[model samples]
Target chain A: MRYAGPAGMDLEKMAVPLENICSQCDYKGTPDCREPECLMGFARRVLSYAVQKGLLDVPGASSLIPKGDFKHYYPEALVPALAETCRQCKECRDNHTPDCVVALVRSSVEYTVLSDSIPYPGSVFMYLARIKEQNPELAALLAGELSKKG
Target chain B: MGDGIFRQKNGMVAIDIVASCGVMTPEQLSGLARLSEECGVFRIKLSTRQTLVAVLDEKGAGRLVESLPGLGLKVSPYGNVVRAVKACAGSSALCPRAVGEALALGIEIQDKYLGMEVPKDFKIAVAGCLRGCTDPYCADLGIVSSGREVFDVSIGGFGGSSKPLHGEVVARRIKREDVFLLIDHVLNRFRALGEPGEKLGRAITRLGLTPFLPPAGVKEAQQAPPDDFVKFLED
Candidate 1:
């Protein structure tokens, strides 16, 4: 199937990157998504989340991640675990489970930032509390690991 | 000392070099390198708007801005003026997929309107095609090539803020010449209506797009929102 449009215009090639970037997402063609009018909105939101979480404080991580938080710094242990969730967010675009923990945390973090109810250190604790409320077993596992390190 | 030099939190001044469409001739590049060396500039940053930024002391900044014009480089205008026009390589031998001459249009726009005072910093971007490599959809005024020498004009797009907006397409498949007239209309309207320090996108958001759009666009805006319960009661 060919798009019989104007000359020297390969609509397919031009449209490929646009389509491929969000093709498998649930919001691929949603009106709210605006045909992916968002050039870097999701990425910005993710970076915002990382900033609020103090994820950029880890050594060697600052160079890779976008700068966000300037005041607070966190321990290095949080990086690998948070990165695993980011990997899930990147991969599970359309295959997201109904109660996906990563999605829940990401949405809650963004909402917290937007609402501006709680400040940073408090917001960090709130994110953890929300995670504990949603997935007690996962929270317990993380708590155990952190206690062991301490 | 010039408007192009902005003082930073670190007590250094950032000098803006208007590298139009991010293009610099080899001679200009060499001149910049020499100037940087002579003026005690330590770092140079490429701004997202296709301008080059050099960090230096206040005295060094004054010297650099003075020397830049000799290398055929212009300093970007500061404070509520149209800055450099951002553009992508359009329809050149290198970029065959482009539907129009984006760089040429960008140059024309910059020549005519750069440094023009408005209510705020007005940004314009041109893309050769739908690929939009230069992110034309995120400019105050955006021109995207729809066909050979034909353009789709959009207004009130913005980015680099907490809230970013995609410019809405107001004119579709218009001729190259009409673009300038459309831009003139938009800029005049924006200047008249916009508050000081308010971005064009914010103005459009605050006041509805009706003032900026054409008659057909106004009609579309009128028809877009569904009649609410309040309207029903009034009726």
Candidate 2:
């Protein structure tokens, strides 16, 4: 459940601004939506992940409905994805569908990164356990990572 | 002027990217190609570690470095650091005995230890199975998976020894869940107990490997994969 996080990060202080920033966002639920490339947004992304997984709920998001790409945040989106369906495949012509293998890999990467930032065992499991049913590979990875940190 | 910058013979700098473990997206590869063409850098080599041996002039390196985080690439130190985990044809459908995902585990190791100071050059390799395709036994720290949820962890088997020792297993039939914990504990112990600049195996040879195991013993380390790890692989 526990993992290493970025050094010198103030998780408690960052939580407030992160929730504030995401509450004002219009693109919060877009499928595989990336955090805008910046420090503040990155922290907000992790907090948003926490809130969505019922790990931590920011006070403001209680009012909004769960709309937009619902599958984007769960293992439901990883089942059909395969390495054969990579998004960056030079040879592949089909440009539709969320089954990109690379996207799945990226999600695994994001999951590991997010877990690392959370800094606790129960919390990391909170993320990995959520996706255990939909994608076992990520769960294995999360365990491996948690062990590494310990 | 930089700590990690390497001077090259071709009026270029060699920036070592040890964390990639040789996988890259087509878009990332294309972006690199464009960068090369634009900068006129002569060569890009994938080194033995399956990392980029990218050679670029100083100016070109600055440009490339700025864009690297965007592409999810990092340049880590080359020597006396925990080198990137060299993975083989394990963890995927390729190897029949895959008890673990070598790339995923390798990336985890890379993320945690890359460029961290070590006593001396340290090489690590992970194999999903015991076929030794990645030469785990020949590395400073070699890990070989032995079961659906078990791994064999060893230390000190570099080929350079006149009589190179096979990586002596510090812990055998370890649970996949505990592999990382064992590795972390063993490495930290090695750092503390080893002589200055000593290789991990040599240090283990002198101190004996018993002190590195979990207090509960190696037997405790063997178990089924975690529920999620199993589901990911089968369900």
Candidate 3:
């Protein structure tokens, strides 16, 4: 599917290695600075790369996530590649996490941050507008997780 | 990374390959493809300036550039050096409107001035005819060949998207043999008179085109067609 967000933002470049994604996602930081760095370490890596390249061209690329985490969110920061990877996962059939840990964990984590009722922290509305376009299944799973938790 | 080389955001170094008048043989293509695989590049991009660009991790760039066969690959890493010359190798039967070989002329220009520094990054293009598929008029200097042995020369073309401007013809119906002489004359004049950082187009605008015209008796001008670009589109 054709995904569009900030102009010139490459999804694969912004994505952390799949194996490295959730190391400490529970710590905090949706699209901004997360404490102790997550397993993926994408936010820090992307920012460092951008600063090194002098590449603050994206619309909201250079903006800093407010200090001290409190429902900090920017759904648009999620890598769209994760959705495509979920489609290829052989374990997701009939909707299960055996082969799709990323899908399950990403949604659950996003859902948790989406509300106190769920299990995570933080709140971001940009993902609501962008997730389905980037990856429908991930968005659906996150919604499903929210519905079940609520 | 040096003068002409720039580091990509992904930490890969982008190496620029100057194509001879945008022409490369299948052997060269296959060779480059093999090199790309060995060097672990993501993809090969065809740049508009008639050059091939490949991004490789910092460790692989030096090795890849070192292996390009002499003459088969000319890497012009950024800076004030002459960029590649773009051209349309006129299809004989398919495009009879073309009288001269734009590609051949482009190669000759490449040999003569591809590395010659003049003022700023001066661009040159050669088109088969008025169709100008290669955007001859948008270059710092350009040639549009019409008859089998004649071309019209234009200067001061700017290709920037923000301020695109078509060059004006300074001479019309120039002989094939004299093309190089005229180009040499233009460059010599530009260097002696142009500001260090000024682009050819901007310099022409500031200094005017009359002073830069081929000196008397060098190449005769036949009324030197008017700024036909603006008129052609508006018409």
Deviation of model 2 at A24, angstroms = 73
The regions of model 3 sitting more than 4 angstroms off are: A1-150, B1-3, B91-96, B220-235
The window of 10 residues in a row where model 3 chain A has the poorest summed lDDT is A57-66
Question: Tens digit of lDDT per residue, candidate 3, span B75-167?
Answer: 864656567788886533324324356778888888778778777878888987666778888998889875445688998897885878889
Q: What TM-score would every model get versus the actual structure?
A: 0.55, 0.54, 0.55
Q: Clashing residue pairs in candidate 1, if any?
A: none
Error of 3 at A77 (Å): 73
Return the TM-score for candidate 3, rounded to 2 decimals.
0.55
Candidate 1, what DockQ? Answer: 0.02
Displacement of residue B205 (Cα, Å) in model 2 is 2.7
Error of 1 at B91 (Å): 2.9
Per-residue alpha-carbon lDDT of candidate 2 for residues A31-134, written as tens digits (9 for 90 to 100): 53444332234334433443332222121221111122222233223222211112122222222111222222223334422332211122323445655655
Is model 1 an incorrect, acceptable, medium or high docking prediction? incorrect
